[model samples]
Target: MRYTDEELEVMLSNYRQLRSQLKDIRESIMVPHVIQDTNVGGSSSGFISNPTEMTAIRLAEDDVLNEIKNIGLAIENTYALLPKHKQKMMMAYFIDREPNIKELEVARRLFIDRTTLWRWKHQIISMYQIELEKLDSV
Candidate 1:
């Protein structure tokens, strides 16, 4: 169940993207779609129920949803296990990382040297990989 460091980093890097996708998916599933009736002169039963509820139920069974939920849950759970300072480092490095920011700047913001930043990243990714492995075992 061990992943290479590269693979672990790739997964960690996807945290924000996965979260955004999850949010979009949830919103799409929850909102009711307007269906246009094609019937011109056909007799109708006039017993139309709310489509939003039914749409949510059907979309809830999607395979992609399960995969995203499992991965997202594991990520959140692992993040929760980190110490407060490590959590801050993770937020700065991955979750809230801004474009065009360099590694040195991130280290400076955290008030740590480049070496400590590298070490902390290693530790965080290792913990995250273990969490993913645990998810796979289940």
Candidate 2:
């Protein structure tokens, strides 16, 4: 199958939009909180049989970090192809090591609801997978 210039243009635009949102998503990983509770290993009666249990609380959406990595890579491949508006937004949102940009701020700045942000993220992952597959096929 083949894509016309318009279709390619739209796809590229969507990628940039998703990349912008993805930029913020990548920065939103929760700081890992390790609960270091010292179990005195008291009387054996009610012992933690294993003695230690570990759990993690992900404050932000978990998969977003993973998707950010994908978006970063795909953006690298396609960055030169992006328009200026998209380039700046995507770069600032995703690739920079600047201060943490809050999620609510990002949502408000993009004029999108939280759920739409999630859907955009999902689309980025799907599009990245498709692009990667095409490269692999080549």
Candidate 3:
């Protein structure tokens, strides 16, 4: 839903890590689960409602995967919604910050001074919040 600037920034900063985690989870899910044979004796005790802890672990992993996917989708969708020039800014600042692009480099690439770059970054964070709001509505 709606996110604060700090939250949005954190999501963007961790975007790459999220993608890697999503990939890892998908790969793990592809692995076959070990099947264990359990023998039941007629001792009327409903002590455990759930039979298999593996099922619970699988459900939790699915939940985590879904959460990471949602965050990644929102970030990508927001990035896609921006104009080409703004997308460049976002890419340099967030998605492609591996080597950490300098302010001068970004300014030169976007043909703007440092002040405008900083302002545009703030604007982009606001845009991300708005985009997340729209997603929540849907």
**Candidate 3: segments with Cα more than 4 A from true spot:** 32-61, 136-138
Question: TM-scores of the models, in the given order?
Answer: 0.69, 0.35, 0.67
Model 1, which residues run further than 4 Å from truth? 1-3, 26-61
Candidate 1 CA-lDDT value? 0.80
Which candidate leads the pack in TM-score? Answer: 1
Clash pairs detected, candidate 2: 23-93, 23-94
Off by over 4 Å in 2: 1-73, 76-92, 96-99
Q: What's the lDDT for candidate 3?
A: 0.76
Rank the candidate models, highest TM-score first: 1, 3, 2
The superposed Cα distance between candidate 2 and the true structure at residue 3, in angstroms, equals 26
- Candidate no. 3 TM-score: 0.67
Q: Candidate 2's residue-wise lDDT over 1-138, tens digit each?
A: 244434443444455467667656543432233434455677454323342222123323356554444434554665554556544444444444134776556556766676765555444434544564554454
Candidate that would win on lDDT: 1
Over 42-68, each residue of candidate 3 has an lDDT whose tens digit, in order, gives: 677534355456555554658767777
